[model samples]
Target: MNLEISIIVPDRIFLRDNAHTIILPTLTGQMGVLTNHIPLLTGLDTGLILVRKSVSSDWIGVVVTGGFALVNDNKITILVNEAELGSEINAEEAEMAFLAAKSALENASDEKRKIEINSQFKKARARLVCFNSIV
Candidate 1:
């Protein structure tokens, strides 16, 4: 049976795929879903959301910083603060951003700005990790 799932972000819609199962990175831990999964809504974390298609054993990885996921009626929808695919990441650019964020945390003047940069660094790192998984 086909399962429908959609992942939407602020700037764009990342995905809408029919699959067999999905795994989400939640605030507390990861979640796995299959056909006929009970409805759920919860806050997310910065990490990978793994997708498995019944067609094969291959897994697709998606990264999101924050947001919520909903599942009902054999459908899944993820509205995320930010999301990116594994293949889209530029490792060098992500590393650069990470370093810049680290510097901001040290030399920056504004506490909130520093925290925001640090959070971006974490998200970028998570993307890098997700990218590695796809390769």
Candidate 2:
């Protein structure tokens, strides 16, 4: 049985489809969901959401920033502040953003600014990684 996955962002829905499996970045670590997986509700980290369908068995990647994930009755729903599909990511632009965030993080003196910059850096880095994985 395939699992239905949906990723929702404030502005738009990033993905909605069926997949054999999904791997998501959780606060504790990466978690993989499959058919009949136990129900879960967890905080997400800035990282990649990997989806794999059984038909072709190719992985689709989506970079998502801080959010939450819910799994119930063979459906997975992800709610994120921001999400970008691997196909939509531009590697060069992502690299530039990553570098800029890194620089800002290094220069941030206040704890709050540093925290924000660090999150940016993580998101940018995840974007680059996910972009590279797309065929």
Candidate 3:
């Protein structure tokens, strides 16, 4: 049996497909889901979501910025604020953005500034990680 997974953002449905397994970045930590897995509902974190279409296939990566994931039956539904496919991201651009975010985070002086910069850093890092995973 395959897991039916859907990645959705406010603007659109990023992806809908069947997968052998998936790894989600949750508030607590990374969580792995497989077919016939028990029902679950968790808060998503800004990170990479890895999907394996089949046992012998390479993993597909998607960068998601915070939301929630619901698992029921053999279906997984992820609703995030924003999402980008690894293949759609420009490697050079992603790398540059990640570096810029990292630098900004390091220089953030105020608590509020640090928190905002940290979110950017995490999103940028997620994009870079997803891009690298698919390359």
> Quick one: RMSD of model 2?
1.5
Total clashes, candidate 2? 0
Off by over 4 Å in 1: 99-114
Q: Which residue pairs collide, candidate 1?
A: none
Better of 1 and 3 by TM-score: 3
> lDDT for each of the candidates?
0.83, 0.91, 0.94
Name the runs in model 2 displaced over 4 angstroms: none
1 versus 3: better lDDT goes to: 3
User: Tens-digit lDDT track for model 3 on 45-116?
Assistant: 999999999999999899899999999999999999998888899999999999999999999899999999
lDDT of 3 at 88: 95
User: Model 2 TM-score?
Assistant: 0.91
Model 2 lDDT vs. the true structure?
0.91
> What is the lDDT for 93 in model 1?
79
lDDT of 1 at 34: 91
Best by TM-score: 3
Error of 1 at 62 (Å): 1.6
Q: Lowest lDDT 10-mer window, candidate 1?
A: 94-103
TM-score of each: 0.81, 0.91, 0.97
